[model samples]
Target: MPELPEVEVVRAGLAPAVTGAVIVGVEVFEPRSLRRHDSASGHFADLLQSRGVLAAVRRGKFLWLPLDSGRALVVHLGMSGQVLLRSPGSDTDRHLRIRLQIEHPEHGELWVNFVDQRIFGSMAVDSMQPTRDGLTAGYSGLAGGATGADGLAGSGLGWSGLIPSQVAHIARDPLDPGFSAPLFLAALARKKTGIKRALLDQTLISGIGNIYADEALFEARVHYEQPADSLSPAKGRALLGAVRSILNRALAEGGTSFDAQYVNVNGQSGYFSHRLNTYGRQGLPCPRCGTLLVRQQFMNRSSHLCPRCQRLR
Candidate 1:
């Protein structure tokens, strides 16, 4: 699944092209992609037609297009999902599941295609509500979000509304400007789990997946199995800094796209994979120290780390 950086890259790439565009039509090649809607494809298409896309917003791995109707179209880019923007008459992708036709006065007609080879991603229409102050309102991943013309009510950005039900449980990611470091530290101090496990907990901190978690832990010289509560204030700060730095760097590089499925809106692969140090560098020499990196099973996924540098306490 795409993490913060990857999803944000797509959002940034999409916002420029899709914002202000009106939905002209929709094509659902596979109804399974709209499984989250609980309704038929006709209704899904009907709800979006003529609606203006105000902003391409994202929180962690979740992406949404805020429409003029107060409701937002929530998008989940599952493990192998790709959202590509192409010219009106371009050849369709073999895996295309959903195609959204939009009319942009300046850019002309365009097609936003959602393609998924594994059928894990889905699109759904969701209701919006206001978030209270700086804290996320309804659920966790639903916390901290992008502000725009359709912002939560009273936030100056617009109404402070948020998409409740589905995303209410996702916590704010560290990259969010509104992310509360004090709150994260307090929560970390209370967790009895491993630091990496805590990092992967969507409800605790959104967006740090296995790959970035390994990279951040390696950079901070913290073991994946280290107890979360055992981290000192300085170490916690270092880890958080590493995460923020890694995410920003990844975003700058267009995110780490090792698989062909992960790409930006232009269908271009990310170059950050070439810059990765620890995620899939097992058996290679550590960049910082002259020690062989190793891989271990973690949360059913493989974790790459330099055992010499990331020693467990």
Candidate 2:
């Protein structure tokens, strides 16, 4: 599954390619990929035709496309969905689920294709009000834009800003500009869950998945089995800082690519996999303590860690 950084990279890649381009047509090859409107076949075509993309934004893992109309197109890439911008006469991949052709006067014609082999990706067009209400009502402020920072501060939530709805459900987002040592420590202090499971909770901290969580835990020299609430404030702060550093470095390197399926918009795999400390490096010598890195399954996900380095509390 593409996590926050990967999705952000995808959004950044598509911004220049599709921004301001007027949608000339919409084609859906896999009907199930369109989650909104049972009759998405005709509805998508009608809504997209002649509508210009006003802005492209990402809230959590979902890409938001605000069109000329009041409606917004929400896209979830799911497991292996990718948005590719192709030039005129370029061949569309057979795995394409949705394609939107944009008529750009100067750039010639551009095709934005959503390709997903797993069929887990989703596309939906709906009113912004319902979307906002649904996000706020159902998931608190953790889905996208949900709560006002001032109100949150007044309510003793201890933070501010346009809190993405996912934040309410997860902990802290290392990539978010508002991330702070104190905030991260507070979230960590409240959980008795395993460190790895705590890291995966979107309400605890946003953007981390199985891979990065293991990598971050390894980098911090913390065992995944450690109880989140048992970590000292200093250790929590250290772990928070490590998470930021690791993720920032990964983003700088275009995120870790596991296979050909996880390439970026340019069809390039992330270079960070080479710098991995423990992830997918079972039996390899640990960089810190020279112990063999170990892999174990917890909650149905593999966790890589160094036993000597990551001592249990």
Candidate 3:
């Protein structure tokens, strides 16, 4: 699954290429990738035709493209979706699940394709309401009452009004400019679940998945099985810092690609995989200690950690 950083990298790559460019055509070779409505195939094609891309932004792991038609193109990469940029007239590959031909007077023709083999990716054209209500509303407090024009009603698991009190039960976004360390600690203090499980809980801290959780826990020298409530305030702060550091580094590296499916728009694997200290390194010597890294199944996901480095309390 593409985490926040990976999704952010994809957003960064597509923003400049598609922004201000009018969508001239749309092709959906696989309809299962559409998540919002049954008629999305036609609606998406019609909405993008001649409509300019105002902006391409990311909220958590979701990608939002504001269009000139007073609507937004909302996309979720799910477990294995990727967006690739191909020059116009370049031979289209069979993996191109959804392609949009964009034309910009200055930049010439560009082809943006969303490719996925698992059919888990989603694409939709919503009148900004679903985008606002679903994804943007999650950041309303951070956005300071600035709601996008599509007028989406805020609705999702653990999402409510713009007040922190309503959103207090929700997890803080590590990428938010106003992410509160104290608030994160408070949330951590309240959970009795394992540290990894707590980190995975969107109600505690949004956007973390199996890969980054293990990486962050390894960085903090905290065991994944450690009870969240038992962590000290300082340790909580360290964990938060580690999460930010790991995510920023991953974004800088263009997002990790464990398989061929995750290549960035330039068709390159994320560089952070080379810097990984613990993730996917089972049976390998630990960088900190010579102890062999262990891999275990937790919450139906594989976790990699150095048993000596990440000692359980």
Candidate 4:
């Protein structure tokens, strides 16, 4: 599954092409892709046609495009989902789930194809909800789009910007400009769960998954199973810093891509996998202490760490 970096890459790639574009056509090649679509419980294609997109926003793993109709188009790239931008006469991508023919003011007509091999990914048209913080929902680019009669850039109600109702509950990612580190630290001090589990909790801090958890722990020199509440305030801060560092580096490297299923809008894979330190490098020597790195099963998944450096204590 794509995590923050991967999803952010897609979101950034889509911002320029998707924002300000009008959906002229909607074709659903696979009905399963619309499983999450509200459609007011009606026709998915009918509700979305001719809706002008304001901007693309992403909160955690959820990506949404606020529409002129006061709704949002949400996308969840499950396991092997890919959103590819292509020309009208281009070759159709395999496993294409949904395709949107959008006309951009500057870029002209283009196809936004949602391709998913596992069918776990989905597209939805959902209602909007104001964020509790009254801040812009998440990271967005090119806030350009069609204005309403009021001459507002988005839905007239878009003051502070609303997010998809489905995404309203998710916490902001570490990279979000609005993320409150002190609040997250306070919450971290309250968790009774392991650090990795706490990191994976979307309600606590969004956009982290198993892979980034291990990498952040490795950078912080903390064990994955280290108790969250047990961490000292300084250690908690360090861990959060490590989280930010790893995520930023991953984003810079275009995100970690270990297989063909994960790719950017142009179908190019990320190279961060080459820089992995602990995750998936079981039995490899630790870079710091030369101790053997190990992988252990936790929560039915695996965690890689250097036992010498990340001792549980």
Kindly list the per-residue Cα lDDT of model 2 for residues 28-67, writing each as its tens digit: 8999998644453348778778987755666455666666
Q: Which candidate, 3 or 4, would have the higher lDDT against the true structure? A: 4
Error of 1 at 241 (Å): 0.5
Report the C-alpha lDDT of model 1 over 1-313, residue by residue, as the tens digit. 4788888877788887888899999999998998777464338888898999876767778888878887778888878888999998899898999999999989989999998898889988776765544443321222344344344455554423454346666787787666789999989999989999999998888888888999999999999999999999999999999999998899889888877778988888888988889888888999999799999998888989999999988
Better candidate number, 1 or 2, judged by TM-score: 1
- Candidate 3 is scored at a TM of 0.83
Q: Per the 3 Å backbone cut-off, how many clashing residue pairs does candidate 4 have?
A: 0
Which regions of candidate 3 are displaced past 4 Å? 37-42, 129-172
lDDT of candidate 4 at residue 208, scale 0 to 100: 94
Ranking by lDDT: 4, 1, 3, 2
lDDT of 4 by residue, 1-313 (tens): 3799999999989989987899999999999899888656568787789999877888888998888888888999987889999999789899998999999999999999999999999999888887787667787753432223225654453623577878888998998878999999999999988999999999899999889999999999998888899999999999999999999999999999999888999999999999999999998899888999999999999999999999996
Best candidate per TM-score, number? 4
lDDT string for model 3 (192-283, tens) is 98999988887667778888999999999999999999999889989999999999898888878877777777766777788888889999
Q: List RMSD in Å for every model shown.
A: 3.5, 6.4, 5.5, 2.7
Worst 10 residues of 4 by lDDT: 141-150
lDDT by candidate, in order shown: 0.81, 0.71, 0.75, 0.87
